[model samples]
Target chain A: MRFRRWILPGILVIALAITGVWGYNQYKIKKNYETTMQNSYQRMFYDLKDHVENVQVSLSKVLLADSQEQNVILLSQIMQQAYLAEEKLAQLPISHKDTAKTEKFLNQVSDYSYALASNVLEGSPMDQDQKDALLKLQNYTDYLSQELMGVHNKLTEGVFNIGEIKRKEKEDIENANDNMLNVRLVKLEDKMTKSPELIYDGPFSDQVLSGKAKGLGDKKVDIEEAKKIAQEFTGAENTESIEVIEEGEQMDKTAWIPSYTFSIPKESSPEDSPIYIGVSKTGGKVVWMENSRAVNKPKISVEQAIEKGQKYLVEKGYESMESNYSLQYDGLVLINFAYKQNDVTIYTDLIKVKVALDTGDIVGMDAAQYLKAHHDRNIRQPELTQSEARGKVKTDFDVDSARLAIIPKEGAKEYLCYEFKGTYQGGDFIVYVDAITGKEVKILKIIKDENGTLTF
Target chain B: MKKAVLILSMAMLVTLSATGYYLYINNQNQNNFSSTTEGINSVEVSNAEKNKDGVEESETVNATLAPKVLYWGSTGQDVKDVQWKLAQWDYYNGAVDGIYGTETYRAVRAFQSKNGLGVDGVVGPETAAALGLNFGPVDGGTQGAGTTAISRNDDIYLLARAVHAEARGEPYIGKVAVAAVILNRVENPSFPNTIASVIYQPLAFTAVADGQINLSPDADSLKAARDAINGWDPTYGCRYYWNPATSTSKWIWSRQVVIKYGKHWFGN
Candidate 1:
């Protein structure tokens, strides 16, 4: 009896001790992880500060430099430092809201410097206006660098815990605005917003940043008209009801095509699966449509699916569309159809159609690219014949076929080229040669597997 | 004699308790260490569980050292793996019958020669790497539910995992919208240029930070990713999205909210 009593108390004591040890260990582990994460964030912030300082210094040096070669070197340094700074800022834990304009400033600085350097390299002297822009950019970067230094000082002094701020923000977002780092960053953004509007021959130039849709015509369509278009696009017989869900009013007026979004419930579709269609408000044309109904096992072949998609596109008034690439996944085959004009394929005006392999029905369509870039192109006669362009390709390419095509390039440019498709070392490749200059323009390797074919 | 017996039993119980405690502490320490890193340890845990089914521990070590070479007479799952990979590439016309016969040997030789490897019929390290089969002990096997014929590095597969992790509970349109946001960021000059770069940027995506991006995507998420890649901008080029109720950052509220789909508020 004495031993039994002692055994019960002994077991109770051991259980209590175990619980205490486990809880303490867990706490210690959590603390260690938080410290490691905090150290990482600190390191990222310091690197960002250093890069911004380097950009500021380089911008000043570029302004003082006279020789074209010296200016190019300094500008390139500025571009590299600005891009690195932007990348570091993005990796920080700060909210994007506090860093939007700051990030944009860095990107514009990089792009503008790159464009200026290219101009210099091409033997074009820097004009007075470009010099003034560089001076203004330097001033902005100077201010940014100083502000970042202030934040760095506060961080080093442990004015506030960065990790604690992140945790508190997640727990209470409204109260997170009081964080010193966020306040300083917000102030920096305000200053950046006042920076000069930069326009240049670059991808991030103001004009290219606010690109307009060339194909969305200027004819106003009301909600009723848009609903009708959506219903017709989704097949009026299969639609039970269509409701206006949202409008694209929040998009920047110059950058995006405004549209009326609608959700239509199909009569025979599964629960929670509805057909969504976006009709451009300018014209009654359907911008995009998707039916998310689950498709059964594939019964139709990929070729049959492609044929069905082409028929659907024709029925919907997409004429002269030539099917190009097709990829299959999860009981669906997505086919890309590009516009063809006078025996030349226009890759810019593209449409994608997703056909259900189970029933060969058109399940999805995206005409956004078509609606953005489609227009009547002025066909130009090729300076080089098909055989001449084929000669530009490597002799070992083993070319199987060649055709005329127009492909897109950077900075909103398009190149008319003769596309050559063939095999090389058991791999399929598409080579594009400029029809005018016969210069090799671009190369794409086609990767094929049981899933589908894709270009890399 | 009775007292002696009781004392002996008591000593045994104490020893048992001490050993149990020591083991519990060791397991906890390992778990703690692994949790510091993300995504990889979950696979290790599953692998450890799989080893309980009478698999010799030494075999696992061997598998880890190097994948087995399949010769003419090799049979079992490894042979089946070679057959499947060869057939997918149209090198092998024989059945995937888990037997390395004359047809399999010829296919291996052809593949080796075509890929600039030594013209040997044996399926060795170089051949397996070319075929994209690691056969690591942790991977368990080549055939599994999540192991599709599609390359893991494929853009669609990566995007599908992101979509599934970020918006598994969202409606189909919402899933597409999430993918569209990622794509829009890729196009924007302020962000990284590549899809993988943008998705894996530090603290850029909650799914990647939380290790959920390693999960296998369902069919709907895969379809959503494909639709987004095909140029369907359901969010109309919005580059940011967040759940309003759960969003931690106060700065996201300052963004111009473009659309609300399911629980996410997409913004520019």
Candidate 2:
């Protein structure tokens, strides 16, 4: 009887010890994870502060420098630093709403600096208005740097905890607002909204961002018209019941092409996943369409799918679209078709068609790029012959074929070039030489494997 | 005396037969050893030649002769040929000096690894054939079959995982909208430029924080990712998306909701 009593007590004590150890280990693991997360956030915050300071310093140097070379170098530095700062800021644990204006300021600064650097390289100095803009931008960056440094100081002094802020942000928004870092960042963003409206030849320019869809015609289409267009685009035989899911007014009026979205069930099985199609409001053109039905094993080849896609495009009245690079994945083939105008391929006007390899059916199509960029272009005879343009390519590059093409550059600029496809040192490359100036405009490396071909 | 002589002759006959049997077995073993080595050499030669035939369209008489296997410490014209090929392919930086030294060995190993051959730093029949060197017979195994073809791009795979984790319970269009939002973030200057950076940005995605982004995606999620990449923007360039019922941030509510798909609301 005495031994039994001792045995029960011993077992209870051992069980309690095991439970205590397990609880401590769980606590340690959680603590370690929190520490690691905190460390990464702290590192990103410090790097962001550094990049902002560099950008400010570089902007100041550009304003004081008189020599074109020095100014160009300083402006390039500002551009790079600003982009890096933007990248770092995006990586931080902050909401996009709190950093929208700040991010826009950084983007504009980078783009403007790039434009100014290119101008200086092309033998033009910074004009007075440009100098004033740079000075204004420098003042903003200075303020931003000061605010960032203040936050940094607080973080270093333990007045603000990034980990605590993350926890509170997820649990209590009011508590997160009390964090000094969040308060300073919000103030900094408010100040950033007052930055100057920059008008220049760059992508982030207000003029470019506000541009409308060029390919949409002027005639407005009603809901009924749009539904009919969707049915026709998706093939009337396959579409059973079409319903207007969204209207043009529902989307962002400025950023997106105004369109009417329709969901149509398949004729074969109306209960299955339906096909979604978007028809533009102005021209009643099909903006995009997708049928997400699961595809089975592939029975057709890539070439056959390309042919089917081309035929589908022609049936939809998209003529003269030449097949370009294709990617194959998940029993489907997505082919890009560029509009061929007057024997010169217009790369900006791109259309992608996804064909299911199982049934040779055109399952999806996106014409957003084409609708954004397609327009009539004046055909011009090349000043230099193809052979002369070919001379601009590297001598060692083994040229296989050459053709005329129009390629897009930065900020709405397009160039007419002689496109050459060839191999250099056993790797495929595409060289674009300006047909008029005979300058090598661009070089693209083509990466090919069993999956598909891609260009970089 | 006659019986003793008979027993001695019988013993002599047994000894002669045993000696003959031993000689026959020894000669057979020697032949077998030689033939086995020859068999291995022929197999290697044939494998190399098959690869050469796949790479080069025209057959040359030089391929008919067995070529010497080059490795570290090898010298002469064969090493020079390998060095020249590697240099042309930008895999080698050393001088093409007729001698296979440490540099040549490293280059050979790198080439072998990239071409999916045995990475021994030795230019055996397979490596030689991959280099388009004229060596060995012309008909054997399929060439380039050892190189694995990637089925999907890494970005696509990552995007699919994110979609699966975040929108697996939503409709097909909603899943596509989630992927579109990720792609739109990549394009927006306010966010990072790469798909990975945008997806992995600190606390930007709930799936990543909850350890769900590591989950394998279903086929639907992969199709959705590809659809988004193909420019099927169901959300129409909206950069922010959230399930209002689950989202805790008051800031997300401040943004104007542009479109609603399934359980999520998309906004700028």
Candidate 3:
């Protein structure tokens, strides 16, 4: 009876020790995971704080800047900072619904700053309204930075836990919003939305962009119609070879306007990079297309490439198009064709055609600019004669040649000028001359690297 | 006049880039980087001449007589020289800073009126000539001119085409290896002395025999070609490559394998 009593108690003691070790290891693993998660949250918070601080500093610089050049730099900096802050904000593991307003506020700041910078660079002084808007933005950002700093300090002191808030957000967003950080951010966004309406011509102005492609007309295109537009653009019709799959949202955010994206295979194999073509649901206009497949051999000359590109443009209802410039890379030549309205070159309306040099196939095309800006333009007749414009060009340099071309000015301004392609000191340059004023406007030097040409 | 205009216009249209009737004008415009003070504040000639932003050209404000020219606020080392030269000539009695400030502007106007040139207060081709500076479009940030240079365009294209055909489906490194193999052969006296001779030698690359080599190449192939030319030999100077799946010759297997990159087994 004494031996049996000892056995039962001894077994109980061993079982308790085993449970103790297992529990300790489990606790250690969980603690490590929590620390890692907390570190990332702290990193993002610090990054947000730094960017917001930069935004404030750059904004103050903008107000104090006396020169337009300095002002442009400051504005560009503010834009970059705002964009970076918004990017970091997206990385947070907070509830999406709660952070939506905060994210929108950051997006506006980025968009607004970019538009202002673009305007300032164009020699247009910021008007009273723009100044007022910027002052408000600066003050608002100052407030945001101060509040973020408070949250960060509190987080580091263990007074508030960002990790806890994020974990709770996954379970219950309302419970997460009860946290001070979310409440404060939401309040800041609300205040920003209530600020004076920003109405201007800069690209970020939602009112101006309309998000609707102007050149596409008013035809409502369904999925089937969109497929036909894709077929016409890629010439991938009547073939079992090309697999067409519709994509809801695009991975690349280059295009300003949203469209119905379609992924179509260029070859029969499953592994090849498929051509991604975006067609606007309205009017069935082909906005953009990219073929990521590797081009083969250069069996055709550059002239053949241009000829093939031109033919494809004409077949797709692109009329009055003249090839602007061609850049050769790999086995393909990307030719930028701008729409010609009258004798004037409408540079704002541009379409890029990628022609394969091996077989002269149109592998890629991007018509976003063309679709957004194309319209019948009322071009004015120039006051100065072509000879008068020519006279203004440097007489010493080998003038090589000159032609009438309308190039974009700051923002949406367009100038009908004489474009002179000349060689000076053995380097090539293109100089633009305002036709009416007979004044030399801008000069761009073409840099020929061993790889290819880059102009500035 | 009409005949002269017609000829000039025709020449302009036909005068493409370095190559004729093929490439278009390069479109990489101004960087909009305004870190430093741009020289010359004078109603700077602008490409945005007229459209919607009614910020009229400052030069064109009052004087159709001044003509479009470079004036105040222009920033460059040349501008400093212009200032120093003008100050030395007693035409401009201002600080010899490169900036075309108000003082420089006044001096330029005074000098132009005194010299019987139009008193537009701007530097035109005539004023530039009077100043004795070679007034061609000289930019400070221009890429420095290179000497001893000539590129074989046909060679780059051929190499790119060959790489694209043989390994279009392969990884980027494998693609470079394909181009590097051709380059390695060109260096080896045992093979060929030039890229063209090695790639076109009879019974060599399989793509040449089939018409696959004639297919168009993509951007990656071109990048690979450029890299190969720039001396990036990822194959460590290997001489030959053959797919292990199809190599039937017993003699080819005798060479020591360098690397089995992607589908091809490379050897020297």
Candidate 4:
């Protein structure tokens, strides 16, 4: 009886304690959840709002701009911005059913904006239909911005409590990285290299040498046969002065790169002798050829020829050159020089040097092989003055700006040149003039409105 | 004295019985409430027992929560083609594995970033719906309600196809030209608000036209496209390419020439 009398009171006190603890936990959880939701909503809302505003600003510029090109660009911008904003908005797990209407409204804005931009990019003249669509889009974007602002205000005021849920959603997102749409493509290639093979079609019967033809190394070139092959390839008129030299002791392992020798009249000087050089990877036919005055002459000793060639290169303003050990072929000695110009180092392997037949003194050198193999290189140099070279430009163009830079030229090293930048009829152009000669060399223009622009 | 004792014991027993009855009724009510909360009906309990004849279906379901068909073979072409296609979406998911896995999915998600589509990893009906192309039936063993499971290699292939069609013959320089053009559009008074909108606003790229952008790309094209995204601009500063051989459009070529690449010349 005594125990029973006290048990009821103890039980009442325990129940009160349990109720208090449970109520406290509920309040804490509710607060945390609300905070999470608010944060997510704020982030998403702000992002969407910013995108919409950007579109609005861009579109406004185009709508008010005088240039038709600018308007077209703005139209594209409007669609892109609107679409991005809507996509982001859709990512949010909004419990508010009313937001569905907002989404539909955003879709409408997207359709309208895209249609207008597409027409503009296609160079279609803007008409009343486009203008009406654009104006409506602007108004719709304004409404969206205001709606997001209201949501932001409510969030700040602590009106909701679903933050924990939102946080969990974000966690799911991080877990589902595979769901990401940003695909980076990795290119896989064959580990080994393959040479391009072009089949050789025949040139058998009797024909005369007419057009350009190349020679293969060690794989002897029968001059009579080569003449016919050239004639068949180009269908050009005939030529005569063809000769075949004796096979040397060292046969090049590769049949592609061949060395050949031909003589001009004894009366022709090294610089005046008309020489033809051709290159072909195939044994029979040439793919590339060039005709130029011979730069090297028959010489005596290899050592004498190399020394003399070095002297000529030095006098021609080349400094700090690296030379290859002498390579003797037939009756001539070949020496190579790798020369440096400013920041660029040029490798000229075919500096075929020659010594005089009588005195054995160094006499001739060739840079033909090196020039044909090389391309204009990239190098650093001092800036040039565009102002001085501006006199050469035509008065028809309105020059906007001028700059000094290194301009690339074919068969030449990069040089400090004057670049004159200007606009003509709304087109951007850059005119390059040689700094030393004040000669107009190249004209490059930057095309505007190429990718199609996005507006409000 | 005996009468008084009996009266007290009876009163005690009556009180004890009343308390026991109250506790029993409360326990029964609690059990009912719990069953309601859990939504576990008696019929379901019977079904659960039957299913657990030997192996537990519940346990199996819990163990294999991940969806089947984890791999998506290349969506288009071969491995090389898939690599190129993925490159277009700006997702360098590595060499096309021809298997759909985490990398491919991540790449797909990233691609969706610039698109106005939901960034769900599964290429679901919504994504397929948005693509709006008549892609032949997917080759998975089963067609789930939402996303069809694809091999990683298949994803790579599909991605490659898209990249190739969108950006073949376009080197890093071409990519830069394309990027510059996009930027120019952004800065211009007219154009779309975001990059995604511009690329996907429909009928923009030739690849996107006639559903070619949905195909896979080869390895070479993929590398070229990637280099472009990395800021290689071969176009220098010119934009616009139209094949003189096939282009019927009259206005694109009318612009002044700014530069040339391969066979096409770009102008403003």
- TM-scores, chain B, all models: 0.48, 0.45, 0.44, 0.38
TM-score of each: 0.74, 0.76, 0.48, 0.24
> Which lDDT values do the candidates have, in the order given?
0.74, 0.75, 0.62, 0.42
Tens digits of per-residue lDDT for model 4 on A1-456? 878665655554555555556555555554554554355445655787798788767756766766667776776776567766755554444321213344434544555555455455546666765565556556555555655566556556766432333334345533222221100000000110111111111111011111112112235565555655544332334535443322222212211133333222222353442322232223443322222221233334545555666775665433455453343322333345554445333432223343343344433434333433333445444334556688888776678766555533322234556666676555556677777667676665432211111110
lDDT of 2 by residue, A1-456 (tens): 868655644654555565556555555555666676577668768888999999999998988899998998999999989987887787666766777788888988998999999889867899999999999999999999999989888887888677677677668666766778778989998888789988887777766666677888778998788877887777765334787773223474634777778888877887778888888878889989988776666789998999999999999999999888787766688888889998898888888988999999998888888888888889689999998988788898998888999987656667899999888876667889989878787676554534564321
- Tens digits of per-residue lDDT, candidate 1, A1-456, equal 878756755765676566557656666666676677677667768888999999999988988889999999999999988987887777666765677688888988998999899779767979999999999999999999999889888987989867766676557766766888888988998898899988787777777778778887788998887877787777766334786664334654522777778887766654757888888878778888888776665789988888898899999999899887777765688888888899898888888888998899998888888888887689778999999888888888988888899987544567899999888776567899999878887776553444555321
Which of the predicted structures, 1 or 2, would earn the higher DockQ when compared with the native?
1
Can you write out model 3's per-residue Cα lDDT over A141-187, one digit (the tens) per residue?
88889878878777778877776774564465457678877777767
Q: Candidate 3's fnat?
A: 0.01
Return the TM-scores of chain A for each candidate in numbered order: 0.86, 0.91, 0.64, 0.29
Report the CA-based lDDT of candidate 4 relative to the real structure: 0.42
lDDT value for candidate 2? 0.75
In model 1, which runs have C-alpha deviations exceeding 4 angstroms?
Answer: A1-11, A64-76, A115-128, A238-240, A248-255, A270-272, A379-403, A418-456, B1-155, B190-215, B242-254
Candidate 3 scores a C-alpha RMSD against the true structure in Å of 27.9
- Error at A79, model 4, angstroms: 2.4
Candidate scoring better on TM-score of 3 and 4 = 3
**Number of the top candidate by DockQ?**
1
Off by over 4 Å in 2: A1-6, A201-203, A237-240, A247-255, A296-299, A453-456, B1-152
Per-residue alpha-carbon lDDT of candidate 1 for residues B1-268, written as tens digits (9 for 90 to 100): 6566556656756665666566566445434433433322121211111110011111111102223577989887668867877886689989999899999999999999999988889877657667655432222245433222323234566688799999999989999999999988866776754466567664577777666786666657877886787677898788989898987766677777777788998878
- Residue-level lDDT tens digits of model 3 in B71-90: 87875545665675577567
